[model samples]
Target chain A: MSNKKSSKVGGLNWAKLGTVAAEPATRACYDPTGVAITLEAKDEKASGGEGIVYTVPGKPGFLVKVYKRETLENPSKANAIRERIEAMCENRACQAMKGLAWPLMPVYGDASRKNLIGFAMRACKGMPFSSLFNGPASVKEKFPAWNRRQLAQTAVNFVKRVRLLAESNVLVNDFNPANFWVDEQCNVSFIDVDSFQIADRRGRPLVTHTYFASHTAPELLASPSALNRPRTVEHVAFSAALVAFQLLMCGYHPYSYQGVPDGGGCGSPDENLRAGRCPLGIGADCRLPDCWYKLWSQLTGKLKNAFITTFRNGHSAPAMRTPLGDLEFALNGLLITMAKDADPDRVSLNPCKVKSHEWIQTPAAPRSFMPRPAYPSRGFMRTPGFARPPYVPQQQYNPQGYGRFPTPRMGGTTSNFNPNLY
Target chain B: MNNNTNNNINNTLGNLDVMNPAPRCPVTILLDVSGSMSGQPISELNAAVAQFVRETQADEAASMSVELEIITFGSTADVVQPFTSMASVTPPAPFVAGGMTLMGAALSLAERDLAARRELYRAQGVSSYRPWIVLMTDGRPGDNWEPVAKRLRAEAERGKFMYIGVEIGNSADHATMCQILPTEPGPVKLQGLRFKQFFRWLSDSLKSVSASAVSDQDNIAYPSVASWADLA
Candidate 1:
């Protein structure tokens, strides 16, 4: 769950896709021509950055996209990504996976320009999670309680879906109330998989060093250890957040996060104890719910022997960071405890059924255990015609940030993935 | 969701391109066969053509998607390969050089060939990228090439073709090469034996496009011509 509102209150040019379009003399290659000729386009003014989005227009339920460049309102790669996803649509597991995915669209990229343009299929039926929560209907009214039994089943099924994905090593970054659309009985599908999952390479020199870096798991971006490790420190963090989100939407919190993005890279408690803004700068306004915050603080030292102690009480600094191996166990333990303590009447939220050995897994290597590789000199880290620094270029893209975060567009924009009008 | 919705959208409004889509790309090769390019230059150029053919053939996506052709002129004009598939193209053994320059004829051939190829690609069930017309010359085109040069400018004004020119050797005047090639205007040069590097970069880029899902090409780095270009 990314912070509801980054609460940071900063805005960057949403119309800056033209930054890479500086004038050049006749260039040698067909810069962006390969992808430019195919857009079946529409514009999402709020987020479309004055660019166009071409969809597989007729296929209502198939794809939706965001354009990264201007010349290509439409591109050939849209069909390609649709084809690949279609190919991967085998088995119930994959089907379920697809159901929750912010589908990957293939893009014909025009990389000849300094900034590459991307093309993909446009999804027509979905909206962003943020929109759903803020929509006109209250949560309870929009979803009338279907007698007690149905509620329990909904929760169980939801947990089952998330747990399976976790077991499969497929982690969803932000999985909370608004991210997925839940029908009356909780039948669900995901939308807005984020640029992280939707990014297209389009066969050109598509190595975007700065591509959606801001959309990454927060901890990875801040870690100096990542310089040498160069490993995915993000997946585990994102997954834990996913677990926390699952619990929160189901009426619980694994621990307590009144902060933005409920369970994100708070790093160590010592790091976050007296925060001006979370390192993630989750924001000053969001505070953890009282109960969880009390428990967290007490477990650290404020209260008598609390059950919420992290792996580091008197241990070392590296041991203090939530190791990936224990992250799942910690989250699962919290969920199990939450469910156990909750009224048994909560049927709709029973998303998991613990098999005794569920929490067993091999311990992963810690950042301290493995040294990261030396980074290239800033000069050598060149993308010849590229302008941005790649991968979440600046923190401006914080999903909860005022301007950079997703916002609702006009109703008739014909977009399936709006941030929701609530 | 259903084929009917697809048909309706494609047929009713401005949405047909969404469904019955085709990948579009136009590829051109500019060859330099000036007196200075007599020996290894031409052999390597031809060899690179063969290489381009094999590479494109292996790349199922590119051969099927891009419209490719070649234009070469030294003393006179020539269409070495009409808009054809690298898969089916049989490059000539080699182009041994002789004559005085006639880039005007080469550009003339390129302009004509690109128009024809673009039409052919659209007609043959494939959409196309902007057409590329490369002009490679060792010295300068014989005859006052200004008229043909004017012709290139007109075509470019209409976005009909993307033209490139190359200047090679000490005999080639930088100011004059700049005039004919127009780094700011008409053509992209291969510098010297850098024809190999230029073509290789081109083939690599096309190959990448052929394999890409997003038919939209972002910026493709041409083989760094900096290495071989004779910096004045």
Candidate 2:
């Protein structure tokens, strides 16, 4: 959106002409201790609504988010961002910022510091949060080390991160997966520090401009025509709860309903959310996948109550929503139970399938099953008298006289994802 | 059912799951190794294929997720390599260009292979991203290609899989390529023998697609095509 001529922001070339200048203009910045740091604005390959992000040399785990010159032209808006950056930097040692990829230092256009472009933050280099919920195919590829247990742990991590942010009096007004990243170790980091609602000197929270309809609270959706409002604590809690639901429930948006309506209910997810009609909650006719209900049933009574309270009872009343801490506690407990029962060859059963149907679980085989690293697909030598093994498909059986499926025997070869163990 | 029988069934099902690998983004590369590409064009393609394998292997995400396949069309289309992940892929044998292009046969093989792979995924209960069929040619097909083109367009429109066609050089039948290619981008002309660049872009794009979540899969943000080809 920047009309100004694009230059090298980092090593990425973003010039419209697709050519880089041998040397671009350099800007001088100072660390908190007043140590002079020289930064050369290099070409950036990626751009966003705000401005171009440039990688600063000598900074291994940080990137500079430089706003477009047009943004800086608005002195009031520029000053507002600058104030937030300075306050965040001053309180950099706060516990809340520990889990956040908080802004580190503000970058000025010149040594005189008249033109403020953007600030630098710790770069989240791991897989995007989308990887966790996208599908099993991607999850298997990118985070090969992750399993269902890790996913549960990731949800807890997000809750903890948000809790820490709230403790520091920061409100993550605009919450969505796009702003988060999860590493192979299941550690979650939040990006886009600039958009966080900061408290003004007068103790008033800044207005939140961004909104994701899927993740937005019903109350906020009801007032669609309203201008950006200061996000309330209840609003933050609703967003956190939705995120927790999405992560814990295998990426199902809390308001996403299944089954065709009888032409009387809210039409789409956005409409359902705005009208506060949660199909999963009380008096709703919609049905979810049997697996979803099974997953929900496995949750501790308290956790189930919390969801009902937030999505059903608190659909209209902001004050009636389940507290974020309570939700975090329940999620943390579930993940702990998952960690205790994590097994590589364990079969994670989905209730969506018929009881007689085979439950699928892929075992973590040794690397021997895989050929050696280099060109393994080739060089297969067939020795004399070597015959291919006969393929025998697994047989599906149903007992002739058994009227009902027998309950799975626990501690035998069959084990299920029991959420109540926590 | 008895407890022992239940356990037995669960164990058998568990083993099936173990044998069933992760969901794969199957990519079938249909190459035109006909007589016209016997010299530099064939060599560039060979080198580019090698580069594609190497680069794809280097990518941590793509190496494990993307299943690569090679089907070359000459006098007849032959599946030189069945679908295999880059993790296990062998360095392909250098192509020897000689016979007439059997592009129709190559497309037929691609469609068959993709359909079979999807069936396998379904049987295993393994979720999959949409499959990709990349067709590269320098000339018109010796056999009928209309039926295959119609099927490809229909399937692509239904969001079943992605079909990409690229003409190798100026001698390529551009009109035929347009008629056969799916997707709005249509068939593109490779800038010179920029096969290496084209393959690199393909690998990178696959990496991005493979990394995205299921809900976001439909809106794939592909890497820039400007680096390798011009849209025709």
Candidate 3:
């Protein structure tokens, strides 16, 4: 393919066009009410795989997300997006929700009003939700005073928004972490609202083909055809639970675990989900990292039970998944429990007994602690103090061969993490 | 007290260190800083590297997961930056082009570094996505590279990592790159020195890969390289 043609196939070229300093260009467009609105696209705010968000010169409270040229060029995709955005704009209940960046109006590209380009929504202010899942050091840098309580509250706020969307008959099919932004108050404002699966006036799905595999339920992952069809609240339950788990556990996927010798092969998150190999589930026989184990142990019994049930039983029985309301209740109770404890604002729910520096230094020390071999003469020195022992190719890839540590037993008694009957 | 209660207390006391863990995605960039790339080429390459870092850091998902390292080949392969998470990585010192291309040694270093990094991840019980090895060169290698090329080709075939080869400017030995990546699409030739566009595409691609679940990772359609590559 020619360079020009191939480049145009995707959406906007953010590199060539520049992200923050796009030249001001005036575009003639119309709003949802058929009012002709002239948008003086000022500065490029953000650009993603699908579209570019631009700030409007006169519109102080809103930003415009212009669909890539390729998206509008495709007749079917353009129509579907236009229909979904229009439906969302018309949904009073959806717009009433304070946290969603709901489409206020569809911006047509031309005077005919038939050409759909993008939509305008309220500009959201906050760091991406993904930032909350970073390492403790990074978390401290981004949100200095945030504690487990704040993290719990963030999860609660996210669940509430998801619940509100469900009530309004909208499903956030794509649960990408970058799509949600959380402010200092733990309020989550969801962007990419146009991609949400919406229901028509007749209660039919305006289906969307977008889902993150890590966030998707097992049933959906097993069936490729189901992705194109309308998703149910059951699917939402699984995703919501996964998000809540990650938020509370500092980004560790519930399915992510170290493989025991007798355990089924080590697999990726989706693979583990497909195999129903949750470390917290019964008969899973896997081990979580030391830190993750501590975090899991720190959760209150009720909250832990909720997660255990949702991941273990809900894997097979979709109906057994914890409801959003129940999760919210559990989280609020957790807050109450925290408030009763000393140092409620402490960074960790269960702070390490070790000194702060020692706790921070342990995980990374293992690599440096390993005995180093004498370096062979090479032309130049490797990056200072970062030299590695010579690489020897393994005959067979074995995850077990790496420095394996004993899986910490939840209560030091049982090997399994299965909670006793509640 | 019951055994379970005693065990719980013991376990808690035994493992007192708290760690915040996330899955990792490591990417090693091998760049040619041969004498032929001394002037504007080196300057543009430096700028592009910085831009790539800035762009990758901007995306929260990529910033959290993507671990970046850089290896520059001139007199000999030099580790400009060791593998570090994007959240903490700063742009490296400006590359000064000086000597013959040591692409073979550089490739070897990248391979070794990646293997070591993966071992570390496994030892730490950290789940990692498929690692990426990107090689960008503007001149032919001065040393023997046939053995390293064969090994890289085999590794790529084994799906150990994603290998991307970029031929920079007119002097790049595209045929040699083609041999190294025989099974995969041949090396892409850069359109002039549009390093910014190339790196941006790379940033976007990494973001997509890191954000995707394992089931859909192979199916991820990278953004068209047409913006910076000469496909024709």
Task: Quote the TM-score that chain A achieves in each candidate.
Answer: 0.41, 0.69, 0.75
Top candidate by lDDT:
3
Model 3: clashing residue pairs?
A: A411-B7
DockQ list for all candidates: 0.01, 0.03, 0.17
DockQ-based class of model 2: incorrect
TM-score of each: 0.35, 0.62, 0.79
Q: Comparing candidate 1 with candidate 2, which one achieves the higher DockQ?
A: 2
Error of 1 at A118 (Å): 22
lDDT for model 1: 0.38
lDDT of each: 0.38, 0.61, 0.69
* Separate clash counts for every candidate: 79, 8, 1
Question: Which residues of candidate 2, in runs, are more than 4 Å off?
Answer: A1-63, A67-96, A112-114, A122-157, A167-169, A173-188, A197-301, A304-322, A335-422, B1-26, B53-69, B80-93, B112-131, B154-162, B211-221
Best by DockQ: 3
Task: Give me the iRMSD of candidate 1, please.
Answer: 22.5
Residue lDDT tens for model 3, B1-232:
1111111211211111125455678898989888999999999999999999999998877887888888888887777777778877899999999989888888777767777777666655666787888899988888877787788778776777777788888888767877876345446788999999999989998888777776676766566665787766
**Deviation of model 1 at A122, angstroms:** 28
Candidate 3: which docking quality band? incorrect
DockQ of 1: 0.01
Residue A377 lDDT in candidate 2: 16
